[model samples]
Target: MSWQQTTLGEIADIVSGSTPKSSVPRYWDGAVAWATPTDLSRLDGKHLYKTDRTITEAGLNECSARLLPPGSVLFSSRAPIGLVAINTTPMATNQGFKSFVPRPELNADYLYWWLRANRRQLEDLGNGATFKEVSKAIVSRVKFPLPPLTEQRRIAAILDKADAILRKREQALTLADDFLRSVFLEMFGDPGENPMNWDREPLSLQAEVKIGFPFKSAEYVEEGIRLCRGANTMPDRLEWSDTRYWPVSDAARFAEYALVSGDIILALDRPWISSGLKVAEVVQADLPALLVQRVARIRSSVPAEKPFVFQCLRHPSFWSYCNPTETTIPHISPVELKNYPMIKPPRELVAAFGMIAAKQSVLRQKVEQDAKDARQLFQSLSQRAFAGDL
Candidate 1:
């Protein structure tokens, strides 16, 4: 099939967003869905139907921002850029986006996926002294080969089905997350209230909080032992993507940094974000991994203590303890992390809760495996669809 090579500006009107005055009370909180890069970053779906904050009519009138119609593709332009989403309803955005209002010839879903596929290239085009930003002009100049209008819609439809599958898998994973949280809550009576009046203690008292080895980039090897960094810590589990390795010879020197099964790990930096938890317990499969810097390993005093502490960190109530400072990179230092309070129940109670947790975890693992299979299918379909092979 033949494709048309064209710049984005040729197919859509690129509009920049602007923020209304924050100090004006009249301009704040109204019916208008006003978005920001932050909002787009947290979006789990392809379409943005509502925003965390709304604006008044006066806010719309007072600023240069336009009321984007449905089907407009919103793309973040600054402060960690290249997040893309489509507006399902009429909306407005802060100055952090350069939105594309698709023309009659273009399908918004097609444009959304195209932008996502080329996000790395788009992000690389950004330039600024303070923080990277891809200007409206830069965005408009992005050229790509497009199929005919009918083909665009057809391709989008195929991709949408694949995307829907991915979304369902994501929903399943989220449900699994919710199930774990629910189990914790039911067994442990809110950690915030400590209703059981369990003994309050510093995390350091019950665990060996050891920071990872500060290995330089030069220390990385092609293959030897897996190194778990801050990025590897996911919500209640470890993620193996972007796994780095260190020389086996150095293993003796960094033996203390080694992780064993059931060790609870936490990302000392940016521990909490709009995304879920940055803490997890090391599973058996993730054994023999070395803890890299900015990640902390919490070796429980006893095997039973592992599940208790891991669940505590996973609790929503623990978010208040992980402070996001005013600095450019938010982090909780090892000193501060050690001081995090935990309510400890009796050994017998914790052991019983751990049994229930093991059963629930088995269910979660099955759902996760299904999600993994679905994700792989979606990724394969997405590649074929984009390559005109769908």
Candidate 2:
């Protein structure tokens, strides 16, 4: 495949976004879709149809915001850059973006993929004293591999199909998660309502909330004991990306933070985002990893019935208590977590729910594996398409 190398400015109009005065009441809560980087981060599909905020006609007229058409490609330029999405409806964004209005020759979806492929280059262009940002000038100067219109559309369609497969697999996993919640509701009733008249107990009565060790920077080693940071704690699973290690010699000193099988870990700081809470379970495979500070490890005081309490902690109301919106980072102290109220059902009933959860866990693992494979294939296709191998 022959590709033409051209700057983004030549094929598309680069527009810098702006914000309206927040103090003005009429400026917001209106019909126009006003977007930010957060909206792109929370996107679940290819096209961004809505946003967290909206602006009125007066606000749009007063600000530098332009009404972007359906095919305009939005690129976040700051606050960890390179979240790319296309607008399905006309929308406007804050100054965090440097969006592109495609011309006759360029396809919006193709440009979205190009921005993602070259995100590192865009980050390299960022400059700032406070937080780094790539200016509109820098964005306009980005050169991309321009394939023929027909070829561009073809590649975009293929990548779209691959992305859809990943989405469907993810949806299956979500449904499996929902099924567990349904089972919980059926067996125990709502933890908040306590309609079943189950006995109430402080979480600390059933489990011990242990904090991680404050390991020094010098204590880090190449490949010794795995160090689990806050980033490793995902919702319902442990994510290994950005994992660190500590020397085995220091393991004894931090032995209290050593994670065991069936231990539940919760992120103590910045735990809440637009997506969900940050909590995970330490499986047998995740052992030999020392828990780092800002992560709290919870273990049942009793030997049996741990899964029963795990589901209680996973309750929506529990996360709400842990993640009440605040001006600073949303956090739940060890004391607050330990003292959390829980509705405990009978042991036999708890065991029954655990049995069903165990079966669902097996199904979830299979779906997750499929999703991972689909993502890997999508990435491979993206690399090949950009490298002119597709």
Q: After superposition, how far is residue 266 of candidate 1 from its true place, in Å?
A: 1.3
Please report, in order, the local distance difference test score of every candidate based on alpha carbons: 0.85, 0.86
**Candidate 1 C-alpha lDDT tens digits along 210-239:** 999888888789998899998888867788
C-alpha TM-scores of all predictions:
0.88, 0.91
**Per-residue lDDT tens digits of candidate 2, residues 146-168?**
98999999999988898899899
Model 1 whole-model lDDT (C-alpha atoms): 0.85
Query: Alpha carbon lDDT of residue 336, candidate 2?
Result: 81
- Top-lDDT candidate index: 2
Which candidate tops TM-score? 2
With candidate 2 superimposed using the best TM-score fit, by how many Å does residue 348's alpha carbon deviate from the native?
Answer: 1.1
